[model samples]
Target: MSQRKRSIITASLLATTLLAASPALLAGNHSSHHGDNQHDMTEMCDNMREGKGHFNKADRQEKMAEQREAMANRLKLSDEQREIWSEMHEEKRQQHEKRMGKWQKKMDERCAQSQK
Candidate 1:
C-alpha cells in the first residue's frame, strides 16, 4: 500500500511489457525473404553468433570459394557462362547495395521524424 511499493510494481509491469513487445518492435520493417537461401543464411548467422563463423580472412575466403564452386556446379554453368554470370552478378550486387543504401536513408529519416 506504500507509495514506493506501488512505484516498484508499476516499473516491473512496464519492464515485462517492453520485453514482450521487443520482437514485434522490429517486425515487418526489416524482414527479407530470400526463398531457399533464408534457412542457410539463418544457420550461417547462428554460426557467427556462436563464434564458429571462421573469422579468419583466409579461411573465410577458402570456405566461400568452395561454396561458390558448389553453387556453380549445382546450377550447371559452363566456364564461359560462369565468366558472363560473374559480370552480371557484380552488377546485381552493386544495384542491391544502392537500393539498400536508399532504404537505410529512408529508415533514418523516419526515425528522425518519429523522434520529433
Candidate 2:
C-alpha cells in the first residue's frame, strides 16, 4: 500500500475505535449523573418528610392548583369536559396519595431497619 492509503486506513480505524468506545464512555458519564440525581432526590424526599424543604401542605396544594389551572387552559376544555377533567384529576390525586402512602411506609421500614 502507498503511504497516503496507509495513513487514511489508520485514521479510519482510529475513528471507528473512538466511535465504538464513545457510547461506553458516555454511558459511564450518564450513570454518574443518574447517581447524583438519585442522591439529590433522596435528599429532597428526606427534607420533605422532615418538613425542612418547601414541601408543606399549603405549598403542595398551591402547586396542584397551578397544575390544574395550567392543564385546563392548555386543553381549553368545555364545561362538560372541565367537569370530567376535574373528576379524573381527583381520581388521580387519590391514587397518587395512596401510592405515596405505601412508598412512605416502605421508606420508614427501610430507615428503621438501617437504624438497627
Candidate 3:
C-alpha cells in the first residue's frame, strides 16, 4: 500500500515483461528476415556439427560488408554521413564480437566439463 512498495512492484512488473518479450521479439525479427525457420535451424545444426559454428571467416566478413553496403544504400547516406555511420557500425561490431567471444568461451567450458 505504501508509495515505495508500489514503485517497486511496478518496476518488477516492467522488468519481467521485458525479459519475457525480448526473446519472442528477437525470434520474430530473425524469422521475418531469414524465412523458413526449419531450414535455417537445420543449416545451423549442420554448421555446428561440421565445426564451422562461426562459419567461414572470410564469408562472414563478406556478408557483413554486403549488409553494411545495403544498409547505407537503403538509408541513402551522403559521403560524410556514410563515413560516420560506418565508424559507428564498426564500433558496434567490435562490441558484439567481444560479447560473443565471452559467450563462446563459457559455452566451451560447459561442454568440456560435461564431457569430463
Candidate 4:
C-alpha cells in the first residue's frame, strides 16, 4: 500500500512485540536479583513486628544505632562522612525524643481525664 500505511504497520508490530515481552522481561529481572527463593511471606509472618504488632520505641533507637554502624561499614564511609552521619543521627534522635515527649504528654492528659 502507501508508505504511511507500511510505517504504521511496522510501528504496530514493534509495539505488540514489546508489550508481549514486557512481563517476562520484568519477572526475569526481579528473580535474577533474589534467585530461587522468591516468596518469603511465610517466614515474614513469623515476625509480627514487621506486619502488625507495635514495635518498641526503645528497641527502635537501639536497632537504628546498630543499623547505622552496619551501613557505615558497608558504605566504607570516610571520617568526615562518618562525622556528618553522626551529627545527622543525633539530630534525628533529638527530634524523635521531642515527638515522644509530646506524645507522652497527650497520653498523660487523656489518662488524667479518664480517671476523673
Q: Estimate each model's TM-score.
A: 0.37, 0.60, 0.51, 0.46
Cα lDDT of model 4 by residue, 1-116, tens digit = 99999999999999999999998887755655465333343333334325333335667777889999999999999999999999999999999889977876775575455446
> Any idea how many clashes model 4 has?
0
Give the alpha carbon lDDT tens digit for every residue of 1-116 in model 2: 99999999999999999999998887654667877876676776677568665657667877888999898989999999999998998899899889988987887776555446
- In terms of lDDT, model 1 sits at 0.70
Per-residue lDDT of model 1, residues 1-116, tens digit only? 99999999999999999999988986764445555455665555555446465534457657756777788899999999889877876687679779967865775575455446
Per-model root-mean-square deviation over C-alphas: 17.1, 4.8, 12.2, 11.5
Q: Which model is ahead, 2 or 4, in terms of TM-score?
A: 2
Query: Which RMSD does model 3 reach against the true structure?
Result: 12.2
Over 10-68, each residue of candidate 3 has an lDDT whose tens digit, in order, gives 99999999999998887655646556755665665556546575756667778989999
Error of 3 at 25 (Å): 24
> What is the Å distance of residue 45 in model 2 from its true position?
6.8
Q: How many collisions per candidate?
A: 0, 0, 0, 0
Q: Of the candidates shown, which would achieve the greatest TM-score relative to the real structure?
A: 2
Model 3 worst lDDT run, 10 consecutive residues: 107-116
Q: Rank the candidates by lDDT, best first.
A: 2, 3, 4, 1
